[model samples]
Target: MRLRAMVHRHHVLGPGRVPALGFLALLATVLLAGCTSQGGAENSLARPLMQGSTAPRAMSPVERLANDLAMADVAFENGDAKALANHLQSVDLAGATPSDANGEAKLNAWRSSIAAAPPAMRGRVLGPAYLSGILAAGSRINTEQVLLGGKAVSIAAGTAPRDTLRLRIVRGDGKIVCEKSPAHARECRFVPTYTQRFRIELYNTGPEDARYHLVFD
Candidate 1:
């Protein structure tokens, strides 16, 4: 029934009515989420929308961090070397600077362990479908950061509210390569063209202001 409804909507929102690009991107995301297996980390994150948008779904600290670490591991195994490389690049930890080699080694070890694991466990080790779905959805929503200078930048979007979003860039041997910002309050369209590993740090510039949630994808 749900499939039928989605198909009908797809047909109704034909090329003439729906723009080919963004709508197709969203549709692809939805399909990917639907097709992925459900359970554990992936299901926990991915099914939030499948279950319903109104209800809140969150992972426990242990679960969330574990998921993140697992993702970082899988990213490395799946030839997503660029993903970690991007994260490292974003951190600007090039050999030019002092750094944490231990952390870099740990990341490498994590990847190595996953790579050595049996093929059957690889997907779960990486993260379930839901995790990928959420990330994919977020990626489609446009995002932009205006470098404020010196490791600081002002993030603006079509609907990003007034707030200072925190950013975190991971590094490998002192270099950044990829980045991701946690979900925020506000809907916007800004695609990040740069490939690097970084995360967002959101803050309310307004004193005593109400909390806001940013939604993309």
Candidate 2:
């Protein structure tokens, strides 16, 4: 949603009418759970809801990362420090390489930002509908899924920035549903008229192995 939070019936609530800050202190649970190994890596305050987009769907880890970042973008534009703090907890700063090439200093800056935010906005949540695998050079992987009728379907995929990955979605009869040329990131969206299976094809045209992650909602 919009990363907007409102006090509802005496509680701070975010998308899907879920409690955003049950109490500012509860956010610590999210930080410890998502950033650490508490209750496993997937524990959180809530998984960002895509309920209307699919029947009881959960965002995959990759999808949740994308959604949280997307929400963080909105928070940044609107100067919603609380939302920014909440959404960013999902980022694995401990293991991430900074695109800025500033190394640990850059990551520490991010940690400082998160640490400085008020206790209320320091948590992250994501759904689960993702696929990931390694593709050898010049190899392809085919996957299929059943998308029910009357729901908006969205899919996002990406590979290492240096890889050339082409993605295509096709129907049983060979009709192309969506296609993306060689690139680092791709997305597809549609609303099917009826329940049906669609095939997803990922081709690695690069000269080395490529790992890909695809998420849907």
Candidate 3:
């Protein structure tokens, strides 16, 4: 998916600025909680505005890195710094620690990329169909209600050398549609008769930690 200009803007009413900002902060906290919670089934089905092509090419290393940064920018612009930070913190740098120069460089680069965005564009409400987070070693499920009209969906996983990630997609009707156990990345094109809810289940079959990023475009 391409990184385009954000359409939704938050306007503050006079004398209600404090409350508005407070509400937004509260909402962010709640959303993050919901992301981490083993919440009940989600039922809303809203189509994603970003649609992927029929045949998407595999992203080059540089392109993939750029896309990850772009997704972080999207989360940041949408006022979801927690999500962006989570993505950065969960980045698997092949055992590089904070003291490691190479690891620090990559970390700093992620921070700088988000910081370099225009101030006015930071902290807006996030849109639908983009999810990113870290998954511990085990079976984990990340569910989202998305509008799917056969758009191409991309799943990217980052983990240690020995780690493995499996992705399973379940439709609204409780039917499994696609399943893939990939070393790092996977892409599939799916078409739904109409907009509906879908569940994305990720299994960390390996012995180490796993991080993933998903987008429908």
Which structure among the candidates has the greatest TM-score? 2
State the local distance difference test value for candidate 3.
Answer: 0.52
Please, what is the TM-score per model? 0.19, 0.45, 0.42
> Global lDDT of each model?
0.36, 0.59, 0.52
| Model 2 per-residue lDDT tens digits across residues 1-217 | 3333334523533353544556555888777777677554344423434333566556544445544544544455466767777765654421212232333343354446554743322243334344545679999988888888889787666565334788788976789988876634446777888899999888888888765555565
Candidate 2 matches the true fold with a TM-score of: 0.45
On lDDT, the candidate that comes out on top is 2
lDDT of 3 by residue, 41-138 (tens): 23222223234325667774322432454445455456676667655543332111232354345455557655442222234343213344556776
Predicted candidate 1 versus true structure: per-residue lDDT over 14-110, tens digit per residue: 7656577888999999887767744456768877878675656664322233234334444555667656444323222211111245444644454
- TM-score order of candidates, best first? 2, 3, 1
Stretch of 10 with least lDDT, candidate 3: 90-99
Count the clashes in each prediction: 47, 7, 7
Ten-residue region with minimum lDDT total, candidate 1? 128-137
Please identify which of the two predictions, 1 or 3, would achieve the higher TM-score against the true structure. 3
Ranking by lDDT: 2, 3, 1
Q: Which should have the higher lDDT, number 1 or number 2?
A: 2
Higher-ranked by lDDT: 1 or 3: 3
